[model samples]
Target: MEVTNLVVLPAVLAFFVLCLYFITKVVRLGKHPNLNLPPGRLGWPIVGETFDFMRTMNEGNVLRFIQERVEKYDARVFKTSMFGDPVVVFCGPAGNKFLFSNENKNVQVWWPSSVRKLLRLSLVNKVGDEAKMVRRLLMSFLNAETLRNYLPKMDSIAQRHIDTYWEGKEQVFVYPIVQLYTFELACCLFLSIEDSDHISKLSLKFDEFLKGMIGFPLNIPGTRFHRAMKAADAIRKEIRMILKKRKVDLEEKRASATQDLLSHMLVTSDPSGRFTTEMEIIDNILLLLFAGHDTSRSVLSLVMKYLGQLPHVFEHVLKEQLEISQGKEAGQLLQLEDVQKMKYSWNVASEVMRLSPPVSGAYREAKEDFTYADYNIPKGWKLHWNTGSSHKDPALFSNPETFDASRFEGAGPTPFSYVPFGGGPRMCLGQEFARLEILVFMHNIVKRFKWDLVIPDEKFKYDPMLEPVEGLAIRLHPSHF
Candidate 1:
């Protein structure tokens, strides 16, 4: 009886000890580390603060959302949940520097689920070595030197676009027409596709696609997301068809490998002989078409609005562009050198971008647990760097609300403070292209017409992109050269 009792008691104790050990481990798993997270509520679960964020965005004062929180929390970095994710909002130049400088080290580029779904396989969705390779490939064609060769083409397209669309019209809707101009340029330079009918059709589809890009991700039929998905499908199908024909042309030696972006993408491969997949190429083409044109179109449309509102600013831009025009022969297209001479004009565009940046902010996902602003940031959390944080800061720019082109002159706003195109390794690949595009558009439009806003008090909103609510109708009075 003693032997049996001893054996049973040892077994029972061993079982109880094992159970206690697991119980301790399970409790530990349920509790997170003692983290000093930034102040602010995550709002309701799942839905979160997305409603407030979207409401402010639609109201054309998205920065107000950030500012209110900054005041409420009294912190540069605050925690909030947006679009169903816990996000840490980083405000000011210090925050911007931390995120921009630490790309792929502590954090990585991340887009919302919607963007990831739509822009799959594009460079924005890629990271590390693969992203680097794709960027290098695109830079090969989009770099300033290569784009310089296309200046004559861009100039010709601008002139023809103005002549065809704005020549005799007394009043015009600036947004749609500018979109047409930018899309046409994209089609011409990217794929060498110049058919007006085709471009017009593609532009309509692209409008649907853009509308759905930042829309709520409800994929039910009749919803914006559903329509955007359909439009994307149609556009991709068309591109695939184009790719098929181009491949045959390339194989038969009927097309030059250096003819256009599509051709360049097709024939080029990484040093290891790895060529981009057909679908990858198609996806990137779509990405470029959207990025390359949409932001520039937005900037150009607003430039017209601002120039009309502020005549003194307009006169300065006009005077600068006129000097460039005066140096050229009759009907001469703008050259690379001509664009370089439009320093003052570029500054005006820069100021407009600063005042009303097309992209409000960008997102990055923490690769691992990190600390910022004395607050612990957990792994997998999203971090946002807002343009308004710096762009609208009184400390960064004096009287930040006022429009001032001279701010960009000489040294310009402090580094990382004016990131209309972002910064670091992931800075915009098309920034130089955008600079040239905006300058050329300015040179052409200001040189030809002095305009007035039909809706003198036009209101605009950021529907995930800044756009005039009324499409910015304007009256055109041709300039007598």
Candidate 2:
């Protein structure tokens, strides 16, 4: 009887202790008196709605996911959990304005764990004054004067890429070749690595690295994340070797301080006499390489797709490009001013971006308790603002589904409505560089060839970034100038 009493007493005490712990947790969680959180389900515990979110993203129509939620909840701002965090998705231009305009105020920049782990020490991983300093340092190299200097080099690379990869082939895979072109350009301009074999090897590694950027942050072996982490390490090791050599060359006067981005990074310093650390430089270089190539690759590939599908638009682009070519002497590379003249072509690129944004949306985390759209948001909540909310809004863009470049003619899209490169303080630093690269590629390709899509209805899916499932094959018919 004493043994039974002892066992029962301990069991009851333990049960009471567990109940009290849960009660304390509940009281703490409910501390905010009259808290009115946004309307939506948290879904399954840790996994939450991430699977559904990713599934929709993979299916290439993430807008449907947002639309369904907005309708069901009947609210512009709705609550949901993603990637194991409570998320509040803000819809429409109002949401965009609030999030972008309020950077570092009530909110700050945030990225997924995959991005943070893979791109350690990059600008995306920075915030507050540190981010600003990095931006200024980077801008010293990516600024207007520097980009203008790269115009001819970009044109030269585009011409060479076309001659080697596209000129001889009757049919070619667009995405892979375009990827090669962008990657090669990035290597040359960023690291001064011009060797084809070296570039090819690095490109393979970057391919693996990029795959993990949006994948689940599982570091286990045999996972995409593992492969990406390994690739990042290899790429960093290669960059470190190059950095060591470049430092010696710069010191010996064999390399100019203004030679390339690597030199610029090595020599430039912030106003506070702060130089970026070695790891920071390597990580930023990796980030730039991915950003400098991948987003441009997507745009360039899509431009080709749209041009093939719409011959009229292709003709319009061709006419603008031909006029620019005609103004320049034979064998003379394009200048910045010449690229500026290709406005119609730019408009087409802009419209394509609007329809199929390279990045669907981005996230920001609340730094403190804040009120948005009459809803009380608690501290530490992840906030999301989708491009689809503005880019595809019928109110902002008339006949949003239709492909019309003329929409960008005069005043263009409303502020915060067209954010292919994002906006506010954290807007993409390489946007202008991408602009020059895309315009140069467009000018070269449209003037030289008129291509037809092998698959008229080729579908693209977003495995974090939009890509053609079949690599976007096209048949090339060379045009005589």
Candidate 3:
């Protein structure tokens, strides 16, 4: 009996030792050794402060929730979790610099599960020299000569969209119309497709894909993921067909074919005298389509919302539009010079993006161990930046919450301060394209009609992008010459 008892006691002791080892490992994973995380209410196991954020959105006060945290917690850096990743969120000028700095090689962009599942591409992960090549190709396509060639196409599309879409609705659900129009415009320029019905159908499928980018990742029956996957597949197939036909058309009409961006991309070689592969072509097209459609829409919606709220700003824009319309440039294709001259309008758009950036938060996973704010950020840990919070940081912008276009009057915001287009080597490739599209739409719309909000004093909310949650309800008053 004594021998049996001794044996059983040893087995029990061994089991306890193994359990203790696991507990230590878990603790280490959960806590950073040197980083002093900002103070905040980290609620419930696993959930953290996610519930608080969702509640803020639910109550239509997301900005207030973020501000409350910044006021209460340490400003330079903070910690939170979403979808189980413990993210280190950076705010203030210092935090912004740290996030945008080069010392951290581990830094990478993070995408929400829905976006990841839908787009299946990320600048933070899949990007490399391929992106640089694509960027060069785009630069060539938007140059002085190229822009001149694109003018007729741009004017025709803009005029057609205005005449067809705006002529119908008294007060339109403006966001969807803007999205559809931009997608069509992009398709026409890049794909060289002039069929409106086909383009509209493609845009709807793409919209489904975008919506799927924000939902839970279960691709089963009655799931957003499933629908998004189906939509994405359809878009991919449709694009494949479009590209295939374009290639054949280019082959047949090699000399006489239109000089759109895609044709240029197909013919032009990189410095190495090598052409992009089929996959590269498709990927770049997808990137352009995604970037062109959504980001431009976001800008237009903000312009419309703010114009509705502030009548003086609207008047200024209208006056500029009228001046351009009455000039020799009136009803003519918008020139690169024309857009450059609208400096105030540009500043207004820039300020709106600064105050109400569409993408509120970003995350970069460290590829290597790095240091920031005097803390050792471990490899595999995500370094996140909250653009909404960063935009509102008093250190970055004076009177941060107020909409003041004059802030961009003399020079742009500090590189780190105004990152609506993102900064560094990875800045948006479609920046020029988006700017031109937006300027064209604004110029035409302001010239045609005067706009005001349905409720003169309605507050706007930020959901991914700052938009009037109840839709941009506006009454259109005919402009008097």
**TM-score of each prediction:** 0.93, 0.94, 0.85
**Which residue pairs does candidate 3 place in steric collision?**
106-366, 106-367, 108-364, 114-213, 115-213
Please give, for residues 237-351, the per-residue lDDT of candidate 3 as tens digits. 8877877777888888843345566677778899999987665666567667877778788789888888878888888877786676676543467777677777778888888
Cα error, residue 242 of model 3, in Å, equals 0.7
Q: Which residue runs does candidate 1 get wrong by more than 4 Å?
A: 1-30
Which residue pairs clash within candidate 1? none
Query: What would the per-residue lDDT of candidate 1 be over residues 149-222, giving only the tens digit for each residue?
Result: 89999999888899899988899999999988889888988999999999999999999998888744656555
Query: What's the distance in Å from true for residue 431, model 1?
Result: 0.8
Clashes of each: 0, 0, 5
lDDT of 2 at 34: 90
Scanning candidate 2 in windows of ten residues, the lowest lDDT window is 20-29
Which lDDT tens digits does candidate 2 get at residues 154-203?
89999899999998789999999999899998998899998999999999
Candidate 3 has its poorest 10 consecutive residues by lDDT at 119-128
lDDT of 1 at 367: 96
